[model samples]
Target chain A: MELWYSEMHTEDVKFSIRIKEQLLADKSQFQQIDVFESNEFGRFFTLDGLIMVTEKDEFIYHDMIVHVPMATNPNIKNVLVIGAGDGGTVRELSRYKSIEKIDVVEIDKLVVDVCLEYFPNTSVGFKDPRVELFYEDGLKFVRNKGSKYDLIIVDSTDPFGPGEGLFTKEFYGNCYKALTEDGILVNQHESPYYSSYAKSMQRAHKRINEFFPIARVYQAHIPTYPSGHWLFGFASKKYDPLEFDSKKWNELGLKTRYYNTNLHTACFALPNYVIDFLEESKND
Target chain B: MELWYSEMHTEDVKFSIRIKEQLLADKSQFQQIDVFESNEFGRFFTLDGLIMVTEKDEFIYHDMIVHVPMATNPNIKNVLVIGAGDGGTVRELSRYKSIEKIDVVEIDKLVVDVCLEYFPNTSVGFKDPRVELFYEDGLKFVRNKGSKYDLIIVDSTDPFGPGEGLFTKEFYGNCYKALTEDGILVNQHESPYYSSYAKSMQRAHKRINEFFPIARVYQAHIPTYPSGHWLFGFASKKYDPLEFDSKKWNELGLKTRYYNTNLHTACFALPNYVIDFLEESKND
Candidate 1:
């Protein structure tokens, strides 16, 4: 059988590639992970019907999703990542020396097992003493958690099917409550190019803004994601990601493939459509 | 007939939608140009086999391509755009008061004619007195041109059919010659994600850098374009787009969907893969 790895950018759009071999398959964790060498799209990795990585452009998605919010809040010592089962986000987040605790809440245990087995590099930080793995529903985890975090990063899948609740205003509200006073929260907002998710993003921003004093939508270029352009939502109680000390971020000396202090500020400078949505929501 | 619009991010990957009707079709130019109201990907427009503008999200591509170079050189008075048949680039460029003359070289008369008919908003700038339309090959125009331009923007199609030459080193060298001493040249480099056209881009950069003092590649979030992330090449003799006067650009009062002074500087920050290519080429 010709194995192919496909990523659903949306229910209507997907990108697929022929694969050389299935690297690992763990049915117990509800994840069948595979690493395949491909002629195009570089080294392809997939888990639970989702594309985890491609050799040609993994850093763009991994670094932007992790580092932007981390850099935004310099005092972020405790971080929580929801649904980054593949551990790519954790690997990137581990680079920060100040991060004393990195908690990963993934619903699927298979994804973690497969990632550790085949995609070792992405899962390298999973075994670190600073990291804690939680096999629980992301929405429930945020709802029930008593401990406040300095930074919470939602590196979940698309806001459809298993990931539907991830996009709800309720989850965002819970996230707002779960963070410390100066806490910052970042979530993977879907492609504004294709779905009604932009409205969902706007709605989430509205709800989060009601709780937190600051909420902003930023963009990153992720080719495999639907529409190739993906938006990330940042909500903070007091700190603005844009007003960071650049000299300090430079001193941290994170050898990044993408994210820097210059980019950290620029990513927040959203396009007019996004700005208009925020403005329109205020009037409503 | 139910017309379906598909944006093939690559030959292997596509995102499509069914349309209610074909809004306009003009066969006067070298390629057939058509616009349609589509259920997915929004208002769809096509030139030949290439997707041009979809009502939903074209500003990402248009603004990044136009404003990056314009921001780099604030004193730009005369601008030349090559192969922007839709006139989206012109609409963006025309916003600046410093831009006195805007010349557009498009080989396909059909694209311009159809754009004027169907995509009137994008084509609106063509009626501006400062605009000059040349229905000729961009390469041919650059070779024969005597006058120099402060900025040259290549807003051509992909490097497949008619646009094949636009991606070549010869075309870039000619673009170098067509600009004034302080002139800057910007072209839509293909996606660093899917298209290994980075080699071609690197080659062009090498050839152009030999003549021009500085050349660099910047990125934009263009979901419709191949790989969802797009790269733009900037080559200049004197001006750096990053060190421009933001106060003046703010005064230009260019109502843009995406480009701002912050983004202008941020676009130049490259990923390690892109930087590696530039460095590799430098060593060679």
Candidate 2:
């Protein structure tokens, strides 16, 4: 018998992967977490039935998220990552020798615990001496922190459920207050393709735009996402990502699979429909 | 009670769309042709269980394929499109007043007949005075031609079945001979994420690279396709797409939903993984 794990992209669209076996299924306080083995994607874990990381393509997501901001401000010494319980974000951040501290705030300890057990490769960054893990709601963790982090990565889930608060105007305002002068804020901006996700993307971007001097949107093709067209929001206080020094980043010679200097520039060049969507999203 | 249309992306992965009704199911001498109506994608047609065009996102595919080369060299007066039976490619080409003639050679007449009947918006370009439809095999049509056309677009299905010859070395060699000195050749180069499709992409690019002085690959996020990360091959005898004048194309003021001056330049900047894949493909 074949066991197929399917995710409803929309109510009318579905993506399915044939799995070898279900490895683990358990409930955390925040969400239901499950792990499965598949031939096409290797091993993957999900939160509340939404795919978090698949072994085959997790590098694409992690590389884009961590490297874009780091490449923008190579002097980024400290980073605050919110909701990346799978530890993929932190793993990429630990690669930079210039980075002094990496603080990960994951509300669900069980998500971390299970990932460490089942996804050792993804969770390997936890072993780094510069990294620290905090089990707390990201919404509350940044409430009092003032001008602390050089970069903030809101590596989150869908705008509903536990991730809903992270997309709020208040949360962005706090994140702005919690960052340094040259701080960069990168978050998992929802896709512009589907109507529902586009609304969330619009809402989050509009709020972030209110606080940041330089706010831009970029895209990557992540096949497992709601639409394969996944977006990232890059909001900065002082630096524009487009004007970043590519030579400085290239001198470091980090072997990356997805993020490169040329692609970094290219990713920000939005399609006309997406540009229109983001433009209309501001008014909405 | 529920009807769904699913295409196996790989043996282990599938993409499914919920259908309101199956509009038509017929077998041409080439392949099985089917059309379906859906709430999400509106109306869509497939060949041998593969999606050709969907009303919702057809603009993305058509916009990228037709506008990129058109923008590269705005003086392009004539184009030869092979295997675009759905008529989306021809429709995009019809937008340019500079384009005097568009000769489309489609092997299957049924794809054109059914699409014109079921997908009026997609097939609308056939009504244009500039477009000339030839229900002949594209491989045979290019055989004797020598330096006749400015642009050749292979808007074909996957490199299998009736479309197989279009990806062969002989066909590409013929296309090379069938172009003007400043001629540009673009084709569906397949996806890079999946191994099987990547091999096809490699094989096609390897063959095309052998014939052209400037052969490069570009990408677009087409969600309904196998990986949503679809690639396009752009080969030319004279012009490098990167060196093209954006201001010249922008001056045309063609209102498009997906293609724009910025994206035209940006789409050519492919990911490092794809670059490495193509590099390795040279030896294979």
Candidate 3:
């Protein structure tokens, strides 16, 4: 007998995985959460029936998100991570010894509890002395704030449901106000291929562009994502990811499975169609 | 009520689409061919239950396959394409006026006939006077051949069925002998994420390296394929794609939907895990 877990990528498209067992399922205060074990993807979980992370490809997402900003601005000392309750983003961030303090604001404590109970590999770094876990709404935490963190990561979900407020222009304005002069913001911008994700991506980019002087989009290949083509947005007061100091990054000797010095430049090289999409998206 | 068509990405993973109807289904001499009309991916077709091409994302595959080599060596005159019955590669190649002759060899004539009847947007370039279609085995066509062509593209299916021979060392060596002094050979390299696809990718890369001094693997995000992370191998006698003449390609003024000058450099910048897999594959 085959137990299949399926998610609608769009109304017309769906992705399914055959699972060995349904490991966990429950309703969090914010949304419904389910976890399953599978052969191809190993262990995976979903929030509100949408894929959030898979054991096989979560490394790709975590690596691409945390490292790009850290590599772009090597002197980054403080970080504010929003909505990454699974602790994968903090896991990657904890690798940087230069980071003096790490603040993680997750709306759902249940997600973190489940992850710590199940995904030990990803939740490993949460115990770091520099890390602080805040059970609060990210929008409220960022709003009416004083100048602070050198880096902010919006490791969010789709634009609907619980993640809706995080993608707004008002939230972005607050994030800008909460950052130091050289602050960098990285967010899980949606994919460019499917229309649903593209619309969300365009809206996020347009909003972020209005708040930040330097804004760019980069891509990574995460097999379990809607299209396996995932994107991340980088917005900063200064630094361009393309001009990465590869020599310095190499000297840091961070042994990574996915993120590397060569990929630093490569991930930013969007296809012509994507480039055109962004241009049209900006205007549309 | 909803009608869904599903394809197994791996034994444990599958991708499905809500279909308006099955447009075409038949068993060719070589493999099973099925085409379906869908709202999301537009019109898509599968060979032996594996996706061959979709009207929505076929441009990504075609653009990457043809333009990468064309951009690498702008002066390529004579070209040979193997197993691209859909005519997308041929369509893109036909845009290059400098090419004097294009010889396409396909083992199955039925694939071509069906594609010509169905996928006209891609098959449109077959009417060009420069392209000569031959129904023959690509492996046999290149063996003991005179060095005539500057570029040989193996646009084949998975390394099973008729395409199995195309991935062998002997076939690559024959392709090496079939090219002019500055010849370039490009072929489909499978994905590196899933263990099943990774094995095929490793074998193809290892075999190609034996024949060509300048061999590299590049990636493209083709979401319809197994991993949405597809690869292409570039094995050349002389040129490296990174050293592309961007100015010259730009002067040619080809309006592409996918490939671009920046991406030409970026595609080769593979992730660390993929690079590691290739290295480990080489030794194994």
Candidate 4:
């Protein structure tokens, strides 16, 4: 028997993977989660039928998310990661020995439970002494805090279902309050290829722009995503990702699969259409 | 009945597009030529069941192929495009009024005929006075000349079947002889994310490196391709793509969707894994 796991990239587009076995299938109070073993992608897990983490290319996403911010400010000590239940974001954040505290906010505890059981490479960071996991809504978790985190990484899902609230103006305002004076806000900005995802990307960028002095969009190619062209938003109060002395990050010498000093500068160079679309979104 | 056009990106991974209608499907003397109309990608055509051009994102491929070299040395008055049957590459080249002549050598005449009928947006370049079309095998056509063209674009299919010979060492050596001292040679380097495609990419880059003093790889996010992380090779004797004064291209005042001055510089900055892989390929 042949089993395939498919996700509708759009109403008219689908991406599928031939599965070797269905590893796990269960539900939490928030969403349904499924784990599958595949030949091309190795092992992958999905939340509410959307691909969340795949062992094959999770390093691409995690590397881009954690390292870009970490490299921007090497002195970052306290970090806040929102909705990264699989713990890949924290795994990368844990690499910095200088980082004194790493707080992870995941609304679904089942995601952490599943990752702990199935995806050890990513979930291994959960055991780090500096790491703390909070099973609570990220929107609410950041509301109670003030001027705390040096870096806030919103490694969340698409802007719908449980992740919809995290893309709102109010949520961004709370995140702004919860950040240090030189804090950097990095979030999972959706793709620009498909119209549906591009709308969410624009909305997130627009909302974040209102809160931060420097708001920029950067891109990475993550094959398993809806569109391989995935984007991330880098909104900061003091540091410009491009203006930083990359020699500081290069001196640390992190062995990364995707991120590097050269790519750190290159990723922020947005395509002209994306720049035009984001510029238009600012007015609307 | 719902119809879906699915291509196995690898043995286990499939990318599917819902078709509004099957526009055309026929076998040429060389390979299968199929065209489909879709909501997301508009109109797209394939060679031997592999996607070659999609109206929605063809601009990205055509832009990167034609403009990068043109911008590097604006003095390029002569261009030889190999296997760009759809005429999209010629369309972008015709935009530069300084380009006095463009010779397109396509192996399959049928691919051009179908595209001319269905994809007018791309095939429109054939109407330009400076554009010349030669329906012939690019390998043999390029061999009959020496130091004739200012730029040579090997815009063929994958490194197999009809496009296989174009990736050979002998073929690259022929192309090297067919270029002027300052000529630039650009070819479609395959994706690095997949093992199968990465090997092809490595082989192509390794061969191209032998003939050119300066050979480098650049990437673009082409969503419909195998991995969406597509790569292209840039090779020249004297012009390092990085050292060019981009202000010359900026003065041309051409509007582009994907290729901008910023992206022109950034696209060359490859990820660490790709760099390491290419470096390893050099030894083998």
Candidate 5:
């Protein structure tokens, strides 16, 4: 018998993988979590049936999300990660030896537990000395924590279910208040392809633009995601991602699979249509 | 009951679209052609069950394929397009009033006929007076031709079945022979994320590097394709795509949805993993 797991990218589009075995299916307080093993993508876990990470392409996500912000400000000693319950975001952050403290706030303890049991490579950071895990709502954690973190990375899910609060204007305002003067706020910015995701992305970009002096979006090619094209939001008070000194970034000599000094600038070069669409979206 | 069309990105990974209706299905002399309408991608057609163009995102493919080479050499007056039966490539090329002629060679006539009927936005260039449609094998057409075209575009399908010859060393050699001294060659280089497509991309790049003095690959976000991250090859005898005078391209003032001056340079700044993979492929 053949078993396949499919997720609808849109109402009309679906992506499926042939599954060898179903590893686990548990309903957490927040959402439905399922883990499965597949020949193509290795082991993958989903939150509410939406692919969160796969052993195959998680590196691309981790490398892009963590490194883009870190490389922008090499002095980012205090790091805060929100909703990265799978531990992949913290895994990449822990690689930077200069980082002194790493705090992760996850609303779901079950996700961290499930990933720790199945995805060892990504969940490895949970045991790192510099890493501290907090099982709580990310939106509430940063409410009054002013200027604590040099980098705040919101490694969130979609703009629905438990993840929806993380995309609110109030959440972004809190993130702004929680950041140091040079702090960089990076969040999951959905995608620009499908309308469902694009709306979320546009909404997030607009909200973030209101709270930060510098706001931009960058892209990565992650095949496990809905469209295989995913985006990340970078908002800052002073440092623009494009203006970061490449010489300093290269000096760090961080060995990354996807993120590099050259790609730092390249990622921000939005397509002309996207530039126009984003500009026009401000009026709406 | 809802109907769907699925394409195997790999043996174990599949991408499917819910079909509002199957617009057309027939077997031509070379391959099977299918067309479907979906709310997500609008009207899309597949050749041998693989998506060729969609009303929604065909601009990304056509813009990246045609304009990248055009901007590199604005003096390009004559062009040869291989297997672009959809005529989208021709549509983009025809916009350049400086161009004197366009020759499109397609092995399958039914693909063109189908697209002309369904995809008017792309197929509009077929009605241009400058377009000369050739119902012939691209390999055979350019075999002995020497310095005939300022540009050659191999907008063929996957490196299999009808499109097999387009990826062969012999075919690239023929394309090299058929180009003017400052000639540029662009082709769909496939995606680097999936191993099947990556192998084809690696093989094509290596073969082209053997013949051309300058060879590089660029990327685009084409969601309907295998990985949504698709690549295109740029090869030239005299003009390097990067060193091309950008001031000249901007003067032409071509309004585009995807391609622009910034992306012209940014597209070539590929991920480190892709760069390493492409380089390692040289010895493969």
Candidate 6:
């Protein structure tokens, strides 16, 4: 039988690569994790129904997700990452010297184990002393936690099947309760071009804004995502993401694939339609 | 007969809608232009195997293409747009009172006519006396033109079939020769995620950089385009895109869909891979 690695950008759109072996498949978390060495795009890891990384373009997604929220808050010593089993987020988050602890809550232990075995580079940083792995439901873990985190990063899958609840208002409210004072939360919202996803994101942002003092939506261009254009929601109690210190970001000297001080500010400048949605939702 | 409006996101992937009628089809141009009223996405436009617009998301692409270069060069007066048959660029450009004259060079009369009829809102400002239409090849028009333009915008199709030559060294050289001393040139480069188109864009930028003193690449989140992430190349004889007069842009008071002062500066911040490409090309 021919083995292939596929990333379902949408229900109808799936990008696939023929593979020589089934590196790993984990069904417990409702995700089939696989590692495939390809002739063209390089060795890739697919979790749930998405292409998480290849040797070529892994940095682009990793850097933007971690650095944007971290740079926005200078005192983010404690970080919580939900659903990043490939360890790419941990790898990037480890660059921050001020980050004392990174608690990763991934439901699937198989994804973590497969990534460690096949993708050494992505898994290398997870062995750091600052890192703690908890194999459990991200939603449940956040709801039960007593201590608050400085930053919460939701690097979950698409809003379908197992990851569907990730886009709900209830999940967002639980996240709000899981953060400390002056805490900031960033979640990977869907593509704004697709109205279905954009609508869901807007609804989630509206719900989160009620709990947090400020809620803003930002954008990043990731080619592998549904529309190539992806949105992220940032909710904070006291800080505005645009008012970060550029000098501090520069001093961090983080060699990143995408995120920078200029981009950190620019990402928050939403298109008029999005601003209109926020305004329209406010009247309701 | 079932009329379907199919937007080819890539050779393999397409976002299609079943339509009831052939609203408008222009065959004079190399690509067939069609506008149809769809059940889900509203009125949509497709050209040369690509999705140009839908009633809902047109503002995002149109505003970013026009406002970014205009905001970058605040003193722009004489503007020249090549291949903007839909008049979206003209509509956005007319928002600036600083623009004294706007000339558009389009190869297909049918595209202009169809857009004028079907997309009336987008095509409204083209009737302004300051705007002049030229039904000619943009490449040839620029070569023979005697007048120097303050801003030149190349809103052409993809780099294959009819628009292939637009992404050439000769075309960029002519564009350099056609501009005023302080003129800025902005053209839609292909998505960097696709290697074939990305390499072509890299070559075009490499050649254009040899002629213009400063050349840089920026991105706009365009969903219809291949890889959904689109890139634009800006070449200037004088004036940096980042060093813009924000006060002048604010005075213009253009209600845009996407382009803002913060995004105007931030879009130029490239990822490490793109930066590395430019650096490597510089050495060669």
Top candidate when judged by DockQ against the true structure: 4
**Residue pair clashes in candidate 2:** none
Tell the DockQ for candidate 2: 0.92
CAPRI tier of model 2: high
Residue-wise lDDT of candidate 5 within B46-127, one digit each (tens)?
9887888999999999999998899888899999999999989999999999999999999999988988888899899899
lDDT tens string, model 1, A21-54?
A: 6555545534455667766665666655666576
Task: List ranges where model 3 is wrong by over 4 Å.
Answer: none
Q: Estimate how well candidate 4 is docked, as a DockQ score.
A: 0.94
Candidate 1 overall lDDT versus native = 0.76
Which TM-score value belongs to model 1? 0.86
- Docking quality band of candidate 5, CAPRI definitions: high
Give the Å shift of residue A10 in candidate 4: 0.3
Q: Candidate 6: where is the Cα deviation over 4 Å?
A: A1-26, A29-56, A164-177, B1-26, B29-41, B45-47
Per-residue lDDT tens digits for candidate 6, residues A83-198, read: 88889989999988999999999888887888888888888769989999999888888895654799999888877766777777788888888888878888887776666676
Q: lDDT by residue for model 1 over B1-284, one digit each (tens)?
A: 64556655455555565667878776653566777876656666776746778766677778898887776677789889999888888988888777899999999887877778767778887988899999888888889465479899988877766777787777877887788888888888776665456665666566666767787778887766666667888888888777788887788777877777777777787666677777776666
- Work out the TM-score per prediction: 0.86, 0.99, 0.99, 0.99, 0.98, 0.86
Candidate 6 residue pairs in clash (backbone atoms < 3 Å) = A272-B257
User: Over the stretch A1-284, how does candidate 5's per-residue lDDT look in tens digits?
Assistant: 89999998988899999999999999987999999999998999999989999998999999999988888888899999999988899999998989999999999999999999999999998889999988999999999997899999999999999999999999999999999998899998998888888889889988999999999999998988988878899999988889888998788777888888889999998898777757866777
Name the lDDT value of residue A87 in candidate 2.
Answer: 86
DockQ of each: 0.50, 0.92, 0.90, 0.94, 0.87, 0.42
Error of 2 at A210 (Å): 0.7
Flag clash pairs in model 1: A29-A110, B29-B110, B72-B241
The global C-alpha lDDT for each of the candidates, from Candidate 1 onward, is: 0.76, 0.93, 0.91, 0.93, 0.91, 0.78
Identify the runs in model 2 with alpha carbons over 4 angstroms from their true place: none
Candidate 1: where is the Cα deviation over 4 Å? A1-14, A19-38, A42-56, A73-75, A143-148, A167-170, A173-177, B1-12, B15-37, B42-48, B71-75, B96-98
